[model samples]
Target: MSGDHFHVHGPHDHAVEHAGHGGDDFASQIAVMTAILATVGALFSYQGGATQNDAMLHKNQAAILKTEAANQWAYYQSKGNKQNMAELGAVLTSDEHRNKFEDDVARYKAEKEEIKKKAEALEEKVKAEDELSEASMHVHHRWAQAMTAIQIAISLAAITLLTRKKWLKYGAWGTAAFGAALAALAIAHI
Candidate 1:
């Protein structure tokens, strides 16, 4: 026989070797499934981060608007104080000064009205932004749930490989399906 000649194994040995290779194939399939699950989990993580960032940005904007509204209210208060001081000065002075202070008071009142309107409008804007932030946070929560499911599925897949349990692989599939459903809901913003 040539050095490169093939040796044919007995039927029983062949069957045993085939069974061993079958186990290896099963392990490889589980590894592939775990990798795919990890990829999906990574995508969900990105979406979760993005939604969280959006919520934070909207909250920040609302805070800024509230701060500006507070500043406007403060300005309105200052105007009110100045008007009162002017009125008091007029009482302590002459008729001409009284007329001038009356004009000043009217101007301050008008300006205060304008400021109040602006502050109220800003409050409305803040409310709207807060609603947006809440919505984004809701989406983020969904994505977070999806991430958790995906992670669980991946862990199950690893356990399946370790224990050579077919049932565990099925459980991994079930969890992966659940994760996909959550991810879909998140994408729909529901």
Candidate 2:
């Protein structure tokens, strides 16, 4: 009976010590994970801000292009009006005035063609800029998603630390992996 009691107590004490060690190990792991999470979170946040800034820059460029295109169209309209006046003058005037008005009409038509080409090119540029803005916005969205996951993972880590649950730590790691994946996708967009 004495031998059996010692044996039981020995195993019990060993189990307790092992349990204590497990907790300590998990605590250290959580500390390391928390640090990693903080670093990744900061990086994701910076990326999100950069992508947002890029989107805004593209949008501003598109707006400027659109404004310039509008100015060019207005100039084209003025040229059209001048061409019409010249055509009317040609019909109502004498031969000397008619020749001059015809020449003026031709010049105005050529200038209108040039202006049309420029305006169309500007429209294309605006479209390209808008597309860039959309792409940047998409990257920003990915970064936002990553940030969300990272934040959740960080919160879970805190919970794991408080509760001393190894399963919760595993769950936190899973969430952190998801966040990292999202960040990778966002970076790959470049």
- Candidates in order: C-alpha RMSD to true structure: 4.3, 7.6
Tens digit of lDDT per residue, candidate 1, span 56-90? 99999999999999999999899999989987887
Q: Which has the greatest TM-score?
A: 2
Per-model lDDT: 0.94, 0.94
In model 2, the clashing pairs are none
> CA shift at 104, candidate 2, in angstroms?
0.7
Tally clashes: model 2: 0
- The 10-residue segment of model 1 with minimum total lDDT is 17-26
Off by over 4 Å in 1: 1-23, 90-92
